[model samples]
Target chain A: LVDALTDRELTRISCGSAFREHFGAPYTVVHRRDLHGALLEACRKREEITLHTSKELASFGETAGRVLARFADGSEYEGAAMIGADGLRSRVREIIIGDGTPRPIGHVSYRGVVPLDQVKDRSHFDDMVIWIGPNLHFVQYRLRGGTVMNNVATVASERFERGERRDYGGPDELDEVFSHTTPHVREMLGYVGKDKNWVLHDREPRSGWTRGNVTLLGDAAHPTVQYLAQGACMAIEDAVVLSGKLKEAGGEINAALLAYEKERYLRTARVTITSRIFGDIIHCRGGARDLRNHLLAQRTPETFWEVDWLYRGIKA
Target chain B: LVDALTDRELTRISCGSAFREHFGAPYTVVHRRDLHGALLEACRKREEITLHTSKELASFGETAGRVLARFADGSEYEGAAMIGADGLRSRVREIIIGDGTPRPIGHVSYRGVVPLDQVKDRSHFDDMVIWIGPNLHFVQYRLRGGTVMNNVATVASERFERGERRDYGGPDELDEVFSHTTPHVREMLGYVGKDKNWVLHDREPRSGWTRGNVTLLGDAAHPTVQYLAQGACMAIEDAVVLSGKLKEAGGEINAALLAYEKERYLRTARVTITSRIFGDIIHCRGGARDLRNHLLAQRTPETFWEVDWLYRGIKA
Candidate 1:
């Protein structure tokens, strides 16, 4: 990716919703020292680095917290401070402040990899398909160099709760979401014929995610629902903003941490609200699907203009 | 108003949504001689002339259509070939288009009026009060010389079908919409109480409002959903743009009329769609109401940002 970017001589970087996934020589993908080495190397060249990982918090500490890591090592890490980029269930999250908890928002999610090679029709390579109804959505996007399609489906359900299934499932549940999709989208997904399922968990905005010198970051500090496609972008911003405040602290890590936490609360709260509001497009069901679609048809891919600033970063 | 403007030497007219009600006054407000004298006087004296009216559609088609207008000698005009600035749903609309019907969107609206003296809080006047919940909305403002408080209530009711109830309503239904309102807003409404109800009708976009020397103007040509509060603003814009195009046509009224029609379609369609999207705030029923309020609370008044150009009028 750096080589491709360097080939173009681009300086500043702000990520869009998707990035191309590349597969090459094993060493080219990750040179033995593993993902951390690759991440650090990217930063070394002034290339903005972003990583998307999902995890949960089992338990908390004042300055540092434990994280449920899903890297190849399967080992947990504890440090003086943690960037809770591990998402909603960040172990760092549970440690920073004990007041927050993920509440069951009564929705289920479905995702799948639809192979583009089998699709035969390549007309949709640069296009996205969003099937929205009152309370449900089925989205399909080209992935894996546009060779494979990534699909995510969501529905508003009354049954699911926090203590239930930890491992979200596959295929059949997603078929139900697609049952009523438009013929064009349904036909495209039909070409792939299978999918995966998961539950969507969301928590309300929190006041603080740090205690003393230790701090929480990204999804650890503030978790957002998926409606805005801002999850990864927000975490990346957390890292950038944290670095900025830390640079200004003059070794007063605690002060820097305070600044970071305070600066972020309002913005994260907004994304939290925006994501949930956008969830309407996903969790819409039955007749809601039609209303949502009609509304979508009316929208110009810029309906949620208020949240644009978040994804665009701090405007330099 | 024209004389006041002339005496003041005003160069521009920019009426925000709050300043929108007095565009083209009904016969009850301005005598015809006074009105024409004012217009002719302005035409001869002023560099520019502008008007703002929110509900003038009550006179949709006075120019191209016949109207039962009684003169001082008890005479009437039919298929009137004069200017139709009467606004949307003009009696002229019925005559020109032969009483075309308004489609029903299955929505009912209630408006409340409060005297400024009755309001205990004035701080909110800087921003409009929008208490929106599932399937209903309570909109309040300090309008008309800032002496009176204006409140508009909107809701989507399955019970209110097209052509079923066109009569203005009273307080019972208004109270029903507020049954789920937050206590704070309910108390506010109780303070102002009811003034009257409005029959919020629906209509699809029309292809053309002119064919010959006569042309439809304002609401007579296009009507809007009040969600974006651009209904009157659009009419005023239409009046201005149509006038501009007419003058530019240089005696080719037919060409100018066609040009105005073509120019207004896309902008109005955008406004139409945006209005409905915004109407989503009031049309939501049940859980959607809570969702809408949550969304609105999270929204910045910068919601105005989305329609800046529309309110400002289309660019060349």
Candidate 2:
């Protein structure tokens, strides 16, 4: 991590070795397409599994021994159980919890992918680099086995803060927000895609994800902001825990779902809450930013105490 | 409010007239003893009300028709329903919700009340004055019709931050913490009691404060840190709502308790959550504090837009 304004290098940890020592595996980052393809290949090997697409869920209900799901295309399916892995705007979650829409946290992110050969400074691009300034941060990392570079630039939107959500966080605003940063950071921002941006939203953590024979999984259960870079990681962890609970339940669907939710409630909530706090720490302005930088700079790179609770996976 | 380190006037809010115009009554500060006495006198005028002292609760349970509360002294009382107005360490809540002790947020406060004649700077004492610095704040205001001044000094304890809970916020540490502040803030700190200090704690807001014929109220339901100065105010609001619900229940205790909890859940939870966020905002350091001061200083004295949602009392 680097302070963008001062060009000062903040603390860096050897995450690969640290994660290997802690969890017997190195911390890994993968492209979404590759991960999704691998998981789909594994599912295709199973005789009982089938795949469907473009089937947006409309509603779901449970009877005495089975669950029924209705889709927007006017189709219905009955199954012994249901798992709502349908992400942030899940209709199943709305039917179960009904907490309304996720909250917009006044941040917008722009991302792009470029070939590694297009990079100007390969030395700085060798490892993951983050440039953090007041209310904005730019991230660079290699993906697809170092063949491509992933770039993400995020900023707290001034227009969003002023209560105009639409047309905010555009390419113009992105350039304006990062104009005060180092010229190197500004140059890097040029690689980011200007055609599209993502508005970040997160839901407050709540407990009741499982009801009857139906339950939620992954982002459907706990959607978090991208600050901690743990949204996909949490979803993967949820899959592992849910699978383990299913095996332990011996075909008892409701019990397995309930156990999964019970095990995941506090952990995922911690990630969601901590990610917001971490965002504030990094995007802080004025005196708080100085204190954050000062405190973070004094830490030893190899000291992984702060992340022990997070990186140390829960016992399934 | 003043920045103690820079001695800069950050913002001045005319809360007196603002609250008066908004609520038809001015925002009033009173000594705890006087407030308690007035409440006790009012309760004494009611024939059906009885006050008990030093009777610590051990546990409570509900039967088909009655709720039974057992005291630590082995005495038991049976009533139609039990309202756990018991405060922060509430045993009633322990039995009902079972969430553990309140979380310590690493803040310590010392308070003292002195006669008006003891104060050297009466001009600053006339209005509620708050001096904020990085990681610490000192507050002063006249109480009991200006016969006395209530002084409070609070700091984010270094020892507490370093994981030493005990012997952390003593007078010596207090002095060391405020040594960098302006002379006036330091002198005001001299009036704060040295012997006893308070460590702050609050709980994450959760639903389900009511079950059966039993329910929670006040800090027992949703304890908050003092940053917003709304702990007592929220508790009072709970009482009003609870009483109204009981009268509307028309002899149905379970209905009444559930109704009260439903009404107070979101509001009180909001206060608890916002208080923590507000604490972070006020106790900010580095660039965040600078931004806070700059933004707040731009506000008009009579602009109460930020507090409209809070100070606007709910309709019963």
Candidate 3:
């Protein structure tokens, strides 16, 4: 990581070493589409699992022994149990929890990918670099076997601060926010896609993930902001734990779902809250920003004490 | 520091090394009365200073060149400038800023000092220990050259949570809050004074400390909660910097005050906000608490990087 204004190196850690030391695996970064395709291929090979597409869930209802899911096309499916693995804005969560829309957290992100040879600057190309500044940060990393460079620039939306939600995070706002950054960071902003932007939103974590034979999973269960880059990892962890609980339940679906919810609730909620706090720390202005820079600059790159609980995964 | 429930050691640092290495002085703990007396004696020795007693400030006003202060006893004094070193409830601040009372952040503390031999248990007497638990913490340290022990117990008030502020933090609440803590921590709670308790308050940091010939200082400028134990320290820092600015400005009082305010505003504001954040960290519950404990346990006691910006004092 580097300070976007002064270009001072804050701290650096070897992701490979951090993962290898804790989990006995090298830290690997892959594109989301590639990972999704791989998972889909693996599931297609399974004999009992069937994949369905173009079926938008409208709502779900559960009885003591079974679940019924209704789709937007006036079709219905009955199953022994239902798992809502839908992403954010899951109809399952809306029906069960009754909370409205996810809260827009006032941050706007522009992201894009380009071939490595097309990039003019190579200073931070070999490593994942985050240039942090007041109310703004730029992240850069290599993807697709190091052939493509992905760039993301996120800034606190002035429009959102002024209480205007729609038509915010535009290309003009992106340029205006990055205009004051260092020359290197400013030049890199050219790589970010201006046509589209992500307005980040997250739900305040709640506990009732399981009701009867129906349960929520992944982003539907606990949608979090992307500050920690752990939202997808958390969903994967949820799947592992939930599958283990199901296998151990001896055909009792409700008991297994409750046990899974009990184990996963606190861990995911901490991630959701901690991610928001991390955003505040990185995007803080004035005195708080100065304090953050001073403290972060003093940290040793090799020390992993602060992140041990996170990277070590859940305790058995 | 230790976890109150399981009696697990978190992390420790030598105060002597921390202060000596950073500030070229030993970390010294003294009673508030003794410190106040020493400051009063030093002021008394100065020929330019006069001490007054039993005088309550009613209001103050200032012209471009002069400041006039009025006391509730029907007396008025005029001077070239005014400094509101009048602490948390300064009338000078009331006249200048008109911001109302400080905000009570939902915590209550009871503190008292007793002779060293009054307590039966002495396992943690030699060290300044803080037993951190969910929404509550107990602190103990030796004072007055180790002849007496100062005990402070702080807990998040249920009454405050229920929106009934008055008559809260009573002795009964104290007993009920510490009931679930370990026996050692519970026993130490007996030493806390039951007659009165302090409801913690701190202001959201603001920047307008100076207005013309009059300015606020100390707690009046940036009152803070006691979580970081830096309230008095920030005040002393303000005094030092203000004096330096005045001496540098020669006869320009307004210029000196403005410069002093500029220099001290960000530093003191950081302290005020950081203290509140520290309160949340120590009082965190459930998953966040678990994460804190796990991370804290992995830290080597001698690593002072996190506090280098704080304990090292301000830059020249």
lDDT of 3 by residue, B1-316 (tens): 8888888888887676754876666667778988899999999999999888888989877886888889999999899888888888777788888789988988999998989889788988788899988778999999988999999999887787667768776778778878878999998998988788888898867777788888988999999999878878888888888889888999899999999988887777778887888888887776577767766877787677766767888754
* lDDT of all predictions: 0.55, 0.84, 0.84
Per-residue lDDT, model 3, residue A110, is: 93
Per-model TM-score, in order, reads 0.48, 0.54, 0.68
How many Å off is the CA of A220 in candidate 3?
7.5
Of the candidates shown, which would achieve the greatest TM-score relative to the real structure?
3
Mind giving the per-residue lDDT tens digits that candidate 2 earns over A1-316? 8898988998787776655876666777899999999999999999999888899898888898699999989999999889898899988899999999998889899999999888786657667888888889999999999899999999888787767868788888888889999878888888898888898998877779999988998889989998878988888899899899989999788999899998887778778777888887777675356556656777886778777878887775
Expressed as tens digits, the lDDT of each residue in A113-200 for candidate 1 is 6566666455445555555543456566675455666666565543232233433323544455556555555565554434335566
Least well predicted 10-residue stretch by lDDT in candidate 2 chain B:
B286-295
> Model 2, which residues run further than 4 Å from truth?
A16-19, B1-316
Chain B only: TM-score of model 2:
0.96
Docking category of candidate 1: incorrect
Ranked candidates (DockQ, high to low): 3, 1, 2
DockQ of each: 0.05, 0.02, 0.19
